[model samples]
Target: MVPSPVEMFRDLPKKVCPECGEYIEEQAESYMMECDRCLANKEE
Candidate 1:
């Protein structure tokens, strides 16, 4: 049986993006933060 990918990181601070109703971490890195539902420019 395949093992489920364990979530390695702790929960980040969440705030919904104005453009998309997706939770985003306050201090999100490129690898860590992204929207699952809609494509939007990641804040730099």
Candidate 2:
């Protein structure tokens, strides 16, 4: 059986970012997602 891209990366390690509540996949991604969320919130 082969796992799809999403399935393969589904359980890789993550954390619920306190600032954005996003399931972050990588350390870098967490920072990027946080900034994006902050920008989105500022716009709204």
Each candidate structure's TM-score, on Cα atoms with residue i matched to residue i, is 0.28, 0.28
Q: List the residue pairs that clash in candidate 2.
A: none
Stretches of candidate 2 above 4 Å error? Answer: 15-44
Q: Residue by residue across 1-44, what tens digits does model 1's lDDT show?
A: 75444542334345675566678655535544446444435432
lDDT of 2 by residue, 1-44 (tens): 88899987786666555686876556543455454566578789
Off by over 4 Å in 1: 1-13, 28-44
What lDDT score goes with residue 20 in model 2? 69
> Any idea what lDDT model 1 has?
0.51
- Residue 40 lDDT in candidate 1: 35
